[model samples]
Target chain A: EAGVAQSPRYKIIEKRQSVAFWCNPISGHATLYWYQQILGQGPKLLIQFQNNGVVDDSQLPKDRFSAERLKGVDSTLKIQPAKLEDSAVYLCASSSGLVFSYEQYFGPGTRLTVT
Target chain B: AQTVTQSQPEMSVQEAETVTLSCTYDTSESDYYLFWYKQPPSRQMILVIRQEAYKQQNATENRFSVNFQKAAKSFSLKISDSQLGDAAMYFCIWGANTPLVFGKGTRLSVIA
Candidate 1:
């Protein structure tokens, strides 16, 4: 079975510039998630989508970051006026069932470097 | 709120040897789950093992096993017969019905 897929394995943008990352979840998976992983830290959930509907996005910085899962299959995360602190890897994951019952499969994250 | 902690920032093990990485978590919910995920330099997060809070039997998969102490809220991963490919950043995660909370992560290095 194919795993989660992401685009532009690496990206670099100037501070204050805008950047976007794309994710395509595994076929048939109902839950999708976007996470940000800073250097030397674990990945933190930026947002979660349950079939195109947001499940949780409390940790997301609304002022600069936004994400959407259109049609419940492909998702996109965008950051406007990116800050140097926003330089990190953005990971996309998908699970078939509730997290407690099913394991999540992650994609090779897109590394965003804001200069 | 649930939190996961990995005190050991880094650890090294000789190839073919064994190593154990420690993790502790706090959660008020009784129906939660614990997980160990491995992230290699290639940047892919892979699920290593998972343990349910109510299960008494420790979860094991091949050379990977978890020592889970529900009462202590401690979950540690033990990798036996370690191989070079086992070197990666390991994260401990806590999850209930909500989004997962991840620890800072422990970097494991296998020396040949």
Candidate 2:
């Protein structure tokens, strides 16, 4: 089965510029997530959506980060007026949501660099 | 909030040898899932193995296995007969009703 898919495998932008990342989840998966991985740390969830509705986004930076899942299948994460500190690997993951364990399938992340 | 911790930042092993990475977590929930994910240089996080808190027997997947101690909130991954392909960043994660919380990750290197 095809795993979660993300676009723009790499991105470079200047501070205050706007950048967006897109994700296409595996068919039939009900849960989608966006995470940010700093150079030396594990990925942290930026937002989560269950089907078309958002489930959690407490960790998201409301001032600069935003994400949406349209039709519950494809999702997009955006960072407007980016800062140098925002440079990191943006990862997209999806899960079947059928069982408790909910094994997640990850996409090849989009590495973003804000200079 | 739940948190995962990987104490070892880096580990190295000779080819065909064994290496173990340590992880510990803090959580109030009794039953949840724990996972070990491998991220190669290519940067795709892949599931290496997983353990359910309710299961007493350790979860094993081929040469990769987990030692899960629920009472102590400790989980560790052991790679047996390690190969160069096993070199990657290993992350310990705690899964529950909320999004999975990940540790900083342990980078493993295999020397041939």
- Expressed as tens digits, the lDDT of each residue in A10-52 for candidate 2 is 9999999999999999999998989999999999888889999
Q: What is the C-alpha RMSD of each candidate to the true structure, in Å?
A: 1.1, 1.3
Model 1's DockQ score? 0.75
**What's the TM-score of chain A alone for every prediction?**
0.97, 0.96
What TM-score does prediction 1 earn?
0.97
Model 1, position B14, has a per-residue lDDT of 99
**What is the TM-score of each predicted model, taking all chains together?**
0.97, 0.96
Which tens-of-lDDT digit does each residue in B1-112 have in candidate 2?
8989999999999999999999999999998999999999886899999898999999999999988989999999999999999999999999876668899999999999
| Residue range B1-112, candidate 1, lDDT tens digits | 7888999999999999999999999988898888999998796789999898889999999999999999899999999999999999999999887668899999999999
Which residue runs does candidate 1 get wrong by more than 4 Å? none
Lowest lDDT 10-residue stretch of candidate 1 chain A: A96-105
Clashing pairs in 1: none
